[model samples]
Target: MYNLLLKEVRLGVNPFFFVLPLITGALMLVPGWLYFIVPLYFCMITIPNIFGGYKSQNDLMFTSMLPVNKKNVVQAKVLLIVLLEVLHVVTAMIYGKISLSLYPHLHYIFFKPTPGFWGLTLVMLALFNLFFISMYFKTAYKYGAATLVASTVAVLFAVEAEWLGIQNQFVSDLFKGSGSTDGLTHYSILFTGVLIFAAFTFIAYRIAYQRFKKVEV
Candidate 1:
């Protein structure tokens, strides 16, 4: 499982992905900026390309030739996806810190990506991963259409959510405010988000396993 995960990471995750957070982090210096959009952008641009490439390259066929179970292969792919998400979030957080330090007077309208925001991001990504993995594997290797559809739906949902938040006062408040890094609510939300992400990820893994099991390649 570990070896499979490493292979996926090497093949799918790349330096461009790592640089994305850093580039977006720099944008945080702009006052009242919506930093959360950074992660969303990362998802929209990269997830489809990476996963779609995997399908086009017949990654499953190559991996299946090895002495690994289909379930483990699926699990490894999911794990690699989760790891990439983590990398994105952590790098953004570090960038947030640097941005704040450089511009102390900057006023952020949205929650400055506290623990709660990260939790929210995790939940969003987990939901996306579940859909992307489940749908892509059903075709047994045709990711282009699946990826395009999934990415479109995910981007539209995110845009609509942001639009609604802008128009609704209560919804806007949910994402507003800034505070010190120490807080119980922040930690609680972070933990809860992690659990939710784990649950959804496990669900995705099961779906992938069942779909991949019947794949002829």
Candidate 2:
């Protein structure tokens, strides 16, 4: 499992992707900007390009021939995806903290980079994984449709969440107003998002594993 995961990190994924989080995370430094786009970059750019690499390299066929079961192949691949997603979010959160300190008095028109906001980001990516993983392993090679559908769902969620932060007074207070700074409220939201993320990703993995078992490759 470790070696397969290493193969994913070393040979399967490009070196550039490792640096991408830093570039995208820097966007958090932009004062009072719509910060959701920071994590969305993973869904938009990272997943497609990385999975495209897998397809072009014939990763499914190559790995299947290496004496490993379909389960480990799927597990390593999914683990790599989760790792990248977490890296993106954690780096962005650091930048988010810096952004807050940089402009302590800045008024945000969009959701602030609070724990609750990061929580929502986790849920957004969870939804992406649920759609993308389950659909991708239908063939375990072609990823275009999976990436398209999943990314669309993620974007829609971000849009709706942001809209709620704007249009709904309670949500506004919770995410942007005084409630934003309340540790209990924001942390609770973050915790719930974490649970949802774990559950959704696990479900995605199970579904993808079952689908991949039937694939000829």
Candidate 3:
């Protein structure tokens, strides 16, 4: 499993993706920007490109020919996705801190780049993994439909969350107003988001493994 993950990091993924976090994360410096788009870049660019490469390089066939089982293959891929998502969000979080420091008094119309906001980003990515993994495993080669559907789910989540944050006073207070100032609340949201992410990924893995098992490849 470790070696498979290493293979994914060193070979399966593109070099550009390694530095993409740096590029996208820098956008967090833009004060009061729609920070969700920072993480959304991964859903828009990385997943499709990485999976497209896998398909073009005949990765499914090659990996299937190896000693590893389909479950491990799916697990490694899902882990890689999770790792990349962390890279993107963590980098953005760092930059977000810098932004917060730079503009201490800036008012935000959207969600602040707080731990809670990053937590919400994790949830969005979690939904992406759930849809993408399950659908991709249906063929284990074709990813267009999986990517489209999953990306849509993620976008919808971001939009709805932002909308609620804007329109709902309690929601706004929790993420943007006084609630944002409360360490316990924001951290709790972050913790809950992490748990949700784990649960969603586990479910995605189970569904993907089952689907991959049925694939002729």
Candidate 2's TM-score? 0.99
Predicted structure 3: lDDT: 0.92
- Minimum summed lDDT over a 10-residue window in model 3 is located at 175-184
Candidate 3 per-residue lDDT, tens place, 1-217, comes to 9988998999899899989999999999998899999998999899999999999999988887888988889889989999998898889989999998998888889999888998898899899999999999999899999999999999999999999999999999888887788888888989999999999989999999998999998
What are the clashing pairs of model 1?
Answer: none
RMSD of 2: 0.7
Candidate 3: Cα lDDT at 186: 86
Task: Name the 10 consecutive residues with the lowest summed lDDT in model 2.
Answer: 60-69
Q: Is candidate 2 or candidate 3 better by lDDT?
A: 2
Per-residue alpha-carbon lDDT of candidate 2 for residues 1-217, written as tens digits (9 for 90 to 100): 8899998999999999999999999999999899999999999999999999998998887887787788998899899999999999999999999998998877778999999999999999999999999999999999999999999999999999999989999998888888788999889989999999999999999999999989886
Which residue pairs clash within candidate 2? Answer: none
Off by over 4 Å in 3: none
Give the Cα lDDT of each candidate. Answer: 0.71, 0.94, 0.92
Distance from true location, Cα of 14 in model 2, Å = 0.6
